[model samples]
Target: MKILIKMKSSLKDIVELIIQEFKTIASSYSILLVLIGGIFIYGLLYNYMYQPNVIRNAPVVVVDKSNSKLSREYTRLIDAAPQVEVYGTAVDFIAAKELMKENKVAGIIYIPKDFDTRVNRGEESIFITYAVTQAFLYYSSIQEASAGAMLELDDRYRPNMVVFLPAKDVLQIAAATPISVSGTPLYNYTEGYGTYLIPAVIMIIIFQTLMMVISMISGKERESGSIRHFAEQGTTLKRVSRIIISKTFVYCILYSIFGLFLAGLIPIIFQLPNIGNSYEIIMLFIPYLLATCFFGLAGSVFFTDSEAPILMIAFFSVGLVFLSGISYPLELMPWYWQATHFIIPAAPGTLAFVKVNSMGASMADIQTEYITLWIQCAVYFILACLAYQYNIKKAIK
Candidate 1:
């Protein structure tokens, strides 16, 4: 009879906590912003910005001082490349620089008068390329297009000279002169920035938005002296677990709907490849959401004001994106940052989602991240309990 009564009391406490959480959410415009605006509204806007996905036909001016057939051929090939367009020919370097200064062109390609002579002499022909500093994509397009055109020209023209060499040495000469390369891009075939960036950014939004909302609520509780009222509920671990579980349940349900939009609907709407099985994506999210919520709750113990967490956590947004190791190579990161990656839920979560969604990875492939998120879930759950226990003690005093 006594054990049953305790179970009943816990159930009643959980229901009351859920009800209070809903009431708090309903009353606060900021919380509404975190739940709705952060997900649906901002989500669409971000997708729209990355709609182009790939950069193409970035303009450049070519300075062809070579005036030889080779330079002209190089120019023709460069103009034909998908990444860049040769907007205009420049009479001199001065003219090319002017165009770049005016922003009329993203880059300048200069083929010196001696370029053909150097190539025919079996010497490396140096072509000067100047790209504007404004956008790295503009520079990338110019460099890629120029380099590709040069390689194609070298392969086609150099082979004719190899015909004159001894038959046995001919193979060696042709192979040695122009090294042939065949590129096979994996995962992102189109090399679209949208494919690479959007997946990771969406996950960060899920994390940061949840943290801010939870932290803001904690800050409000601290300010309102409600931390003291938590003491009245009792200091038992059972009571703390009830409060934590109920709060986590509310956010999980709300975010699950948001996660579906982020993982399922938004991808379809934006035409991001939804290669992963639906069940797998949903399963990955369970630990991710739980970890994020508990981590937020644990970290919120430091907030003394409602606005402090918004200011503090919001600053970490860009850092968190970098930490995802999408834009930057994870292997290149310092040891400490790499160690920190395992501690944070989103680092592995973002990479795992991308592998599954974009790379068509199996459950076994993402097992490392799957396990890491659960580890985080366990660690943060304990931390949140400890934080709440501390709050309860503070309240009693």
Candidate 2:
């Protein structure tokens, strides 16, 4: 009977704290800014910037030292490729290099003076191509254009001299090439960077915004000595549990709306891949939001001032994006980094969200990530309680 009464009292305290927390959040303009502007407004802007995800017709300068029909043909074919354009012709290698240095071109195709002579003499010839490595996309476009032109030339020059052989042997020889290969970019059919990147980035934004806002609120409470007010109301566990529950409730409710906007509405607006089942996407967020809430609460212990979390955590956005394994393969990462893959909610959350939303994966396909998020929820919830308990004691002193 006494335990039941205590439970009821705790529930009542938590309810009261939830209302108080909402009022506090509404009053603070910064928290509202993060919850609204950072999550939705910034999300829209980032998606817009990446809307035309694939770069096409990147400019390149051609150095035609050969000045022969064969060299001119190769240049024309390269220019015809969708990925690159022959923006200008350079008289010398030095002029081509200057064009690249001046940002006039992303790549250079140099055909040596001996190119035609070597081809005419039935000797193997090499075409030297240089692409700016500053951006991988630039390099990729240049390589694709160069390879396409070379392949076309090879098909044209391939001798049809199989007449001496028997009919079957002739056919086999005619059909044979030095090598054959095909590449398919699955899931991301359009091969658009926005399609590949925006979904993962949206989840990371949710995680970052929640942490920054919650940590800032915690810092304000600590700095203003309001933590002691909660401590005075009950035992340490009661105070900590109530605080965690209250804060978590507010953020979870608020961020669920943001999450829906990010994972659902924005994708529709931008025509990004939104193939995931709506219910499955909603189910995925249950653990994701909880884990983020608890992690933010536990980490808020380090914030002495509201500005501290902003300054310290803001720079970690790029690191979080990399850690999510969107930019790199998880298999190639070291053991410690792989461990971090499970530890950080964003890593697993981003991967799972992409699988379901972009790749049309079912709940079973994301079982590992779903379970990992639940584990994070449990672990971080305990840590949050402990951190808040310690904060309460510190405030009392």
Candidate 3:
């Protein structure tokens, strides 16, 4: 009977603590900004900025020194390509450089005077292309369009080289090649910068904001000495466990709504890839949220003031994104970074979400990441309990 009464008291304490956390978050303006404005506003702004997805008709200046029918035809073909438009012709390389300096074009294409001569003689012909270093997409677009134009030019001229042969043999010679190469971009059909990046960014935003909020709340409790009130409730292991549970429960419920808006609605509004089974994405998200929440709770012990978390945790935003392996592949990373992937929730969570959501991978495909997240959850949850126990002890002193 006495044990049952203690159990009832602990349950009541957990409920009260949960309600207190809600009231505290509602009352704190900084917490409100990080919770609502940080996630919703930032998510919308990022998607809006990248909404264009693919760059098209990027302008390039051509230096056509050959001034022949063949060179003119090549120039026309380059302009017709969807990736780039020929803004104008420059008489020489020097003139093209001036246009590039003026930012009049994203790239320059240089066709040498021997361009037509080499083609006519059935010799290898090469043209130079220069793209500004401002953006890789500019260079990629220019390169793709130029290479495509060159292939078309090759087909048009190959028959001319075999003019003396019999018609059937000539046709075969023009068509024959050592090998054929075709490239098809999977998942991201357009190969847009936005499509490739935004999905991962969304997951990072969730991890970061949740971490900041938890740290701030923890810091506030310590700084204001409100932790004493919590400590006074009880210093038993059971009480500390209940306190951690209550805090985690409050954060999870709050972020579940936020997660829906972020993972669900934002992708639809921005037309980002959302092909993953919704249920599986949620299942993946569960461990990720728990891992991040408990990870935040554990780390909050280090924060001495509410403002400290904002200052310190904010610096990690870029680092966390890099660690997620979206910006770079995990296989090529050094052994230590690969190992670090296991410790950080965002890393596996981001990769798994990308595979499931963007690549349409099944739960089976993400088993490694799914398992890693649960491991982090288990590890961090224990750490959070220990951290709160320390805080409660300090408050009692």
Candidate 4:
């Protein structure tokens, strides 16, 4: 009778608690920081990382009118830069243009009949060329890499083209003469702003929604003494466990489907090519999605008023997104920042997306991350179970 009276007294406070917690969550730092950071990342990505370093697979046809060893060396040097590939060696200008018209080659390099003579005489010689404007930035990088390789080869062969190349240009000297680079830029081979940024945004949605929904229910159940009734009624440990587990499973399935559609399927529908195997991407994320749901559920069990869980989630969401390299790549960040990123879930999550969508990677590629996610999931499930069984009773009393 006393317990029933106490319950009636507390019913109004429960409604107030839900409204207050919701209000507090709405104004939390995680929400604010995520919004601000999202804008910052978009601005930074366009202004910085999207700047092309080199074309991935541009076709370059060589016209050796000189038929000299020097022209041959130049051809070889240009072909090795990780961007340019030898389309065809043309006998003359007309043949090269034929290849270009066929779209078999992107650019043509014309070596005049006395190419070596001009260089040996220390005469300024223009290596005439044909490169149409196609994604000017990518073309420019290919041009620069080609030109840089030519000058470098000139130094090695001329042995005097640059007084400082061998001594002053430390990186040039240290790198192997034929040091190579290539871009197997897999998913979103186009690598446009939307293709890259949108996947990360999807991940943000997944992490946020799963944590929010799970926390809302778990926290509400705790403060309302529902957990105590379940415990006191001896609602059977198996059933109590099933309740949270079922909810967690539902959240996981819902967000995983939502994210997969947003990140994986939509890009393909929009014509973003080379977006890896859809099945592989969906399969890989199962463990990660599982980990996040339980991690948030565990947090809910520990938090009484919901304010702390909400705040913690908000902090982690923004912090994790930044650390994940969704906005800016970890490759460009300072060494210390790169080192710190690996510990965060966002790092692994972002990498997984890049691999599945961009790289055409299989299970072998993400084995380490898959194992990590499962291990973390196990840890969270254990903690959640322990908390509900032992800690909730104390908190309620």
CA lDDT, every prediction? 0.85, 0.86, 0.89, 0.63
Cα-based lDDT at residue 352, candidate 2: 94
Candidate 4's residue-wise lDDT over 1-397, tens digit each?
A: 9989866644543444445435544555654344334334433343343334235668888888887887788888888876778787988888888887888888887878888887766565557666755444545655765686678666776545444344657556556475578785445455455455555655665666556556655675666665565454333344445544655555564556566555655555443433567787777677778777677766765667544565666566566667777667768988887776654455676667666666677878978666766777788777666656664556446
Please report how far candidate 1 places residue 322 from its true position, in Å: 4.1
lDDT of 3 at 159: 62
What's the count of clashing pairs in each model shown? 0, 0, 0, 4
Tens digits of per-residue lDDT, candidate 3, 1-397, equal 9999988998998999999999999999999999878898988877876776776998999999899999899999999999999999998899999999999998999999999999888788889899886665677789889999999999887767785467898768667776777886888888898889889989999998998999899999889888888777677767888988899899989889989998999989988899999999999989999999889989867977899788877788778778888888888999999999889899999999999999999999999999999999999988998898898688668
Stretches > 4 Å off in candidate 4: 1-191, 232-240, 268-274, 315-318, 325-346
Preferred candidate (TM-score higher): 3 or 4: 3
Candidate ordering by TM-score (highest first): 2, 1, 3, 4
Better of 2 and 4 by lDDT: 2
| Candidate structures ordered by lDDT, highest first | 3, 2, 1, 4
TM-score preference between candidates 2 and 3, better one = 2
- lDDT (10s digit) by residue, model 2, range 240-357: 8788988899999998888888888999998999999999999999999999999888887798788778877778877777887888888888999899989888889999999999
